[model samples]
Target: MNEIPAPVTSVGKTLLARIEDRSAVIGIVGMGYVGLPLAFAVTGAGFRSIGFDISPERVADLNAGRSYIKTIPANKIAEMRKGDGFRASADFTEIASVDAILICVPTPLTRHREPDMSYVVGTATSLQPHLRPGQLVALESTTYPGTTDEVLRPILEKDGLKSGTDLFIAYSPEREDPGNINFTTSTIPKVVGGDGPDALSLACALYGAITNRVVPVSSTATAEAVKLTENIFRSVNIALVNELKTIYRAMDVNVWEVIDAAKTKPFGYMPFYPGPGLGGHCIPIDPFYLTWKAREFDLRTRFIELAGEINTMAPYQVVERLIEALNRRQGKSLKGMPVLLMGVAYKKNVDDMRESPALKLFELLEARGALVDFHDPFVPQIPETREHPEFAGRTSVSLTTEALAGYAVALICTDHDDVDYEAVVRCVPLVIDTRNVTRDLQGTYDNIELA
Candidate 1:
């Protein structure tokens, strides 16, 4: 709520010099998926990184050279610890030791699908006591525009410490794609927007060291918008294909096959695959953030909302398909019938199930009187989620032949590479292929059906 602080050159210049020489100690808050990779990327660029987390377990794991995230191996943490490159701490007082602090916390949606700024607000409040005049604070969480200037600025400036002048404030949203082999934090180009010229320069310098490129936008709001735009684009496109999948399904056409052939054109034709529903932290959640923010100006995000509606209905449609398949194949009612979800992770080969449709599918099936269990090589036990806490503590059953035969139907929610798709087709009586993992073995088995 404070006025945008005037840019002070002296502190900004000193910080820029420190970043350039790799003398700057970077502080990364929330040592989860995004923060963990970024900390290593910072250290890889020769900067000593101190990671901060609220979880003592996470801090203990990192300090002991262990990794909770699947993609980041334990040996990598060991390598980072070799020369005291990276350290994770629960103490916020350590915030004073770092030159720049990046807030990489989650911006999850509430039950009403509204932006829950609790994590961001809580993180900033915790850092308030340790906030210094010369330190930089950059938010790497995906949020709507004005979050940096409006939401964070007021909270950080609550004590009358000017943001742009004293504490350099910036918003450089994290574009972390978990389990992405092609792009790492260092390879991804970072988009940065600062409160002012001084803040921008320091943020750019800090990110510029770790990343291959830094896209300096005009203001903090613009940077926030960049991340939302990226996720929204994917959300809309995926929704389009999901809609197409339904239309093509009624025509007895394969959406996966259509996409495979269509992508061969290779010009003005980028293929986005259809899924059971929108999953991950971004596609399912970010568009709603924009739509929620849009309501403040009394404007409706019709396209985004429609896309959201379509994606939300996806799990229901998939459940209906499973119901139909069971009735048609076995001539048995869904009531008391056992169903197995092949994968619980949001995406292939990743243990992240933040908003995975598999959980939604589980709930939907169980609500319809079907007994549902899951079998994911990646996710052995369903972790506690705010929306689906009822599913928590349920362990994944083995995909053995006897286990597969016991289920009335198997739904391939996620197409993890390690899964034996052929074995699933061989054992399961009815298979609902949402991800088309059984595309190659279609002729071999008549039991497989596309969701």
Candidate 2:
């Protein structure tokens, strides 16, 4: 491990001037879900943006006007590539051309549930060679408070480049909500902080160019903590509702109805619903990053750990519900029963399948000899997994009475707007609605059940 760098001298004035004049060349690293959209938004906002990724294929795709990320349109990439000063490449030699850089890689969890900083560290190392004076580097990857200080700072300062002084370094966490049609990269409020005043001002000025709102916190650690707090609050709240859902089920109460009624109150309560399990890159993983980092501080985050445990158990509970549903229909268990899963995408609309609960549900069902077939209109080919065969060439069937008649039981995992509830209720024999897509059609389907 290398020593962390100090902030650059007069960084605040220089960075502010450069960003104001649009002379700051923005370099975005790890152009995945978060990076790509940000790159497009920044480039479209009149700043010259350069995308940097280690994957040659990703760079090639971007240069060729092709986008692998679902939310980022290929046409947008094409427009950016053809636009005035937008370029993407795998070569680190072009890193010197960047005046500002954002690190947007995934900080995924290890098998042991520890925070994996390999990608962040690797990205820092790659950019070290081309690091120069008066450049502002912001880490947008979601991790613990000390990540910017403990992990990235050392890697960037290995060549004696001072941070906050020679090079302004900050941590401005990216709040990218994938599959969200309403809020986008430009609309969402951005949180920015850094080691000192110089780093903070630079980050604020830079992000202010793209977003309307910029929240300047005290330090980089506090900014990192902000993202974790947002995610952990969600995790804990969802776990609370999930726990309540189980109790309500035993009491013969529909949790969805309860939530709808509670939502009407509009004053004291905010509704967070239950599902098969916590899915997506943030809810399932972000809290654990905080808990893992807490251990280093000799602090035990019991709330976070307990929330994680409860949320993780939800998938198995859902499988049990499916088994119970099958037992009522056909005197047998999950074993050898053909199950059709509806919607494999993590959320309702967009096509990002990363960390989707549907995959976990499918895997759990298949482990018990239950035949599982998934249909997600957003995702065409159901790629092969560790447990399932290469079920490629599969596509979403129209949610009509005739199309769903073959399946014995249908599990509604993601409620995409295009799916017709009336048609699904009329067709599927038995339905396990995790997302409550069938709640309104309860009177229509006598066989519909809620998990």
Candidate 3:
């Protein structure tokens, strides 16, 4: 709903020229994990870049030389802004002034496990009136197959505008793995798919200017499916390991040690450890989008459903494991037990807690009448969720030994660097290591239980 600034018609046309001359003005929408880094990379690749976000605070942060997103550095953002080519705005109207528009917005799931395309729809619709000839539009949001053709194509082509000829449309999924220092936006090979040849050519030319390689696909649907497959593969694998964790626990064999021994095979094995549950932006949610679309073809994706089942049950399983561990320690039940949770972030290092299992664990514990408090150095504040009202707007406590010892059982939710594992092991009455962070410690008095 943002208004466009003054017409930079020459600047807009110059961006297309820059695409050929490697001086394109790249506009990245939704300046989150994928978008912000991409904007940085485009600027780094000698192209002018603009970062757009719906959050005015995010725009203000960029303008203030600060980065709220964990992965992007503050100086890199500042440098991009200080440079002539880079700018940040909340307005979508100025999108007409850019040659290439990359939609990096959030694609969340509805309550019924359907893909919520509001952000995608809003962005695409906003650009409809401003749709200029020969402008390349690539949807970088992770979505279902027909999203580009069915949703965006119609919305964009509403005003007698032909795709591929008048304006280019494509799909290129963002494969951003946060906290990954080795591979980045420039190094990661991009997947490009277009409505037609011209779209393909323009998308390829645009991305090729920044990225090292561009893998072209048949259609936008294929590109969309590729992203879904990547995340579904992860979801299925993690579910397999989590299910095994439960089975192995009943058999009294340590799943981690079993994985360790099996990992020695080296040839056919890829080790994926079990934990409290799935977190992060992609793996937990993307499969459901695919499954939802598959239903239209009368296809029931069993793996997708099974993965969801197993991953969804992980938090409850962690609570059960905590009960078992606590029972072993005090010869009593989880009722009236003081349980301390360690690390609430979705992953080990990053501060992102979206779809985190730790939040689920916290709610389940409180529901079972167990007193619970979380300690995560990376994530100081835990946001609100639909189900857990008790933990809404609560902040994470310090991971001190006193905090660890006060609880009857310490549940390791995330394994952040700031936690003093040795101290927790020595002082805590009982420990449930979800991420195996405290398994190797020697000071524990046989009180530590890894889930």
Once fitted onto the true fold, the runs of candidate 1 whose alpha carbons sit more than 4 angstroms away are 1-8
Question: Each prediction's Cα RMSD?
Answer: 2.9, 3.7, 5.0
Summarize candidate 1's per-residue lDDT along 315-421 as a digit string, tens digits: 99998888888888889888998888889999998999999999899998899998888888988899999899999999989878888888888889999999888
Off by over 4 Å in 2: 1-12, 383-403
In order, candidate lDDTs are 0.90, 0.84, 0.83
Ten consecutive residues with minimal summed lDDT in candidate 2? 1-10
Q: Tens digits of per-residue lDDT for model 2 on 161-269?
A: 8876788789999899887878888888999887667787777778888998888888889999999999999999999999999999999988888998999996999
Positional deviation of 354 in candidate 1, in angstroms? Answer: 0.1
Q: Which residue pairs come into collision in candidate 2?
A: 6-163, 7-163, 7-164, 7-165, 8-164, 8-165, 8-166, 9-165
- Report the C-alpha lDDT of model 3 over 120-194, residue by residue, as the tens digit: 998888879977776788999999998999999999999987885677789999998887778999999999888
What TM-score does each of the candidates earn?
Answer: 0.97, 0.94, 0.93
Candidate number that wins on TM-score, 1 or 3: 1
RMSD of 3: 5.0
**Top model number, lDDT:** 1
